[model samples]
Target chain A: MSPDRPTLTATPHNVGVDAAVAAARRVVTALLHAGDGSAAAMAEVASRLTAVAEHLEEHAPTRDERLVDMWAGEGVTRHDPVTGPENAVAPPLPLSGLPDGSIQGTVTLGLPYQGPPGCVHGGVSALLLDHTLGVANHWAGDSGMTGTLTLRYHRPTPLFEELTVRARQVSVEGRKIRTTGEILAGDAVCVSAEGLFVNKHLPRPR
Target chain B: MSPDRPTLTATPHNVGVDAAVAAARRVVTALLHAGDGSAAAMAEVASRLTAVAEHLEEHAPTRDERLVDMWAGEGVTRHDPVTGPENAVAPPLPLSGLPDGSIQGTVTLGLPYQGPPGCVHGGVSALLLDHTLGVANHWAGDSGMTGTLTLRYHRPTPLFEELTVRARQVSVEGRKIRTTGEILAGDAVCVSAEGLFVNKHLPRPR
Candidate 1:
């Protein structure tokens, strides 16, 4: 249970340009984990990066593009961060639907996804489970936006080890869809998530 | 309510190298969001970045340096991706403990933190709340790793907007500590999280 309160701040200040930018972002993420500790060398690299940033800011779009705004980045089409086939950010889950309507996928997180020493970052586990639950909703024919996500870490999800994920639609009531999923490293279950998604009839950007 | 399944995974893979690498990651995250779609120009930048990565991997640390594994790298000392003063991965919550043993902080997430089109990533919200709840436990003299985190999203936490967060220790049940917190965008409550932390007596790397 949570406190019923109001805490409205402000709307988004800037909108992202297009989906292509996220692709570039995935690349940047790969490079960041791969840097040396030379101050002079890094300074030189920073200057170049700054120049690129300034140019984009100068010419960046003012209006938001309705392109997919997901970690998977127009998933199943081009490269993406979460589920892309060629990108380093992906756990690269190749999913197949079971006969029971539940979805199952396999992935292996590497050093790039670490947060707690050798274990996978807790958020990364949430991210993967969220996406998996969303996929469950999509299979249910109610592809909707995530209204809420709840997660419990039974144990640390490991990296560099092949893991299996399974998600199923628990229920679909009106616009609200509920789904549950669990992550497993072999037979051992590590993380579980429950997500609520709302399918909007009104026009909303993807 | 969860399966009392006894399926635990293997231990973590490895600890991160050093604090300096996180600083460099912050740079990479920024540069990725800044690219303006010049493939030729980015390719050139990529080449230089590749060289830097190769050099660092060759000279990376072989032993633990006791550096913080958090975005607060070398914490309160150097810049990092999650809790740094000048990093995009951080919400930069400036927190203080209240009279009743609660902690409060204010944060405004800009670009590089978006999950949905205009809303803050649910995982990001969880990340901020998880850290805040842990900070509250620290104030109460019982800091521990997250065992379970349950969150409910009442409304979308917007990006690029100022939000207020508060956390308080609720109860201590043996080794388990339960805490609750909420995030508000002004007055509208966007997200709420309940965390369970258990301070282990065994030696664990930072």
Candidate 2:
């Protein structure tokens, strides 16, 4: 059974949704990177964004209905927090499947994802790896819920620089699947992760 | 030496920035929840948000300047991805220090952080635990970079619900600080984590 769930997939939309999400992310990044400490200006921007929210609310479907639509068509692909084009919080990593049964992508994070000084947050790296590993599983024709994840931070992942992320399945035994993944700043591996995922429909022994 | 870094701290701003971030996050949430597949409406919303971004850019300071200001005071306290008020990506967890050298917080996540059908992304849980463990270190008067993190997802952490997060220092050996944390939905622990952090001023073993 594919542990494919509805909420993780992208919803049906034209190219316009992608563009809008991209625009929203740009707004988020700019807000994080800029701010001259002007209270009046801040209020003004807030009011403008609030108006946008109100307009969207007036024209959109409820989130629950949207979730069902995503799963009905694409299964577990797209719209994920790590790679969903519709999610503004996502850097919305663009990944490709490899001939060797691996998956990899590149993303340039900015101030919005920063944690240590100019580096990416340790957990964000984990988020990327987790999703990448899931994609790797999908590439290998298997899927499961993340059961355990282990990560080692070799160095700080810098912000505003292109970073490579890759993941591949290591082994699968019945309901359990193991995968390994890493994030790289150029040639330097900044963080590496291993995850164990359990098939969602299987019964567990107590 | 406090493993305090400037990027993780919140910048000096009046209540206006806080309100602005909150509004911006609401916009993000609404965008994710609504959107009825109307391309023209989406375009209109995108244009409005783009204008807001441009207005802020015209009036705000650069990100580097903001980073410098965050570290010059308070030192590794706010503006963190897990608890920063200025960061729209943060659930902006409300955390409190405990007398027993622990830190605890509560946050109700919405669609922006979802992964599994109705559950929080496993990686998101890791993100919360990682930040909470760092808070535990801070409450214990110590701080360091995350060296290794391990997580076990006992159950799916649900979205749109108040979740309790808690962390405490388990041990400190020289430059190594070990902390444990967990995310609880009501009384059930959904995810638990252990992390090893290294002090910034100390030399790591080869």
Candidate 3:
């Protein structure tokens, strides 16, 4: 059901080239969680942001060139939408592999990630679990593209609270890798997922 | 298959605000796609971004208050991660209702959304279709939480190109709704999804 409508007053609002990246991420969270809600204020924030963007663009290479360069080193890991430090959209979740062969991380989401009022978007839960599953496969000494993924939502994932994400490779058969993952609000599972990955080699970037 | 990494130079960089919102979205895209990549440059951008954030904070409400205010109207639609204009993380794909009870939209993503070098992240594809399916449910005069969603990645979804997303309601059984959708690169399907939604009433904000 829709919530009560309020007249929006309107207002507005990344990383360096890690701390810079973190600061930028905060910028997004702050804007979404506590923006002025006034049009004039939003315009002012936008203008300043535009100036910053223009400055960055002034020294940056083309996107195609950047894309090629990203694969050259740590770009793939550094710019991904889930954990990439260079990506502002990512909660930038930093995943660590456990000795037990699972990958895990914790992230506290905010208004920018909301869906059903005060809760994390259902799709976002899938995104976190999917990415964590990929990392689990990597930890298990395998890399593959996701072939199929299935998810179940157990409960609403509240916003502005730390949620734990965990995943593990369940089995590997030839080129097939099966993994399971979950997003937890404390000890309660909010969403759980299962994935099948195919280990076929993808073309490398030139 | 990684690409070559050119060392990131550091760099740095929203809206009332509708215009402000668009500008802010551009800031995120520009930073992800064309950032200078140097620590120094990034630090400078971060500093500027922090200043803007602090300034916005000066006039903003608290996160809890904003959360309440959001459901009070456009906030729900305007702040969601997939379609919320206020959310920079969203590619913010806009969906339209079709004559035959379906929903559709088109968007072009770039580096911020990449998973496999030049391709759109698999999870991101799931995010898109899930949101589109929700919209489709709304169009069909039914609303429900996503009970189960199954996605099959038929092929890699390429980034930086216009991709079409479409979903339709298949059937309704008692309080259950079944829907199917896909992400397409031109005419070719990249990822297809089936979702089961339960028509349970969720609590609303006061």
Q: TM-scores of the first chain across all predictions?
A: 0.65, 0.87, 0.86
Candidates ranked, most accurate by DockQ first:
2, 3, 1
How big an interface RMSD has model 2?
Answer: 4.5
Write model 2 residue lDDT over B1-206, tens digit each, in one string: 12332123244344576777777888877777664364337777777877877777776665667777654554554556777777787887766666566777778998888887767888888888887888788778778899999999998898889999998999999999999999999999999999999977322112
- Docking outcome class, model 3: acceptable
C-alpha lDDT of residue B164 in model 1: 92
Cα displacement (Å) at residue B173, model 3: 1.0
Model 3 agreement with the true structure over B52-119: per-residue lDDT tens digits:
77776666776667766767753236677887766778777877766667777788987778888789
Ranking by lDDT: 2, 3, 1
Q: Candidate 1 or 2, higher lDDT?
A: 2
Q: After superposing candidate 1, which stretches have Cα over 4 Å from the reference?
A: A1-41, A55-59, A63-81, A84-100, A110-112, B1-40, B63-81, B84-96
User: Regarding DockQ, does 1 or 3 come out ahead?
Assistant: 3
- Clash counts per candidate, in order, are 12, 0, 39
Q: Which 10 successive residues of model 3 chain A have the least lDDT summed?
A: A5-14
Judging by DockQ against the true structure, name the best candidate.
2
List fnat, each candidate. 0.14, 0.61, 0.66
DockQ for all models? 0.18, 0.45, 0.44
Off by over 4 Å in 2: A1-14, A36-40, A201-206, B1-14, B36-40, B75-77, B201-206
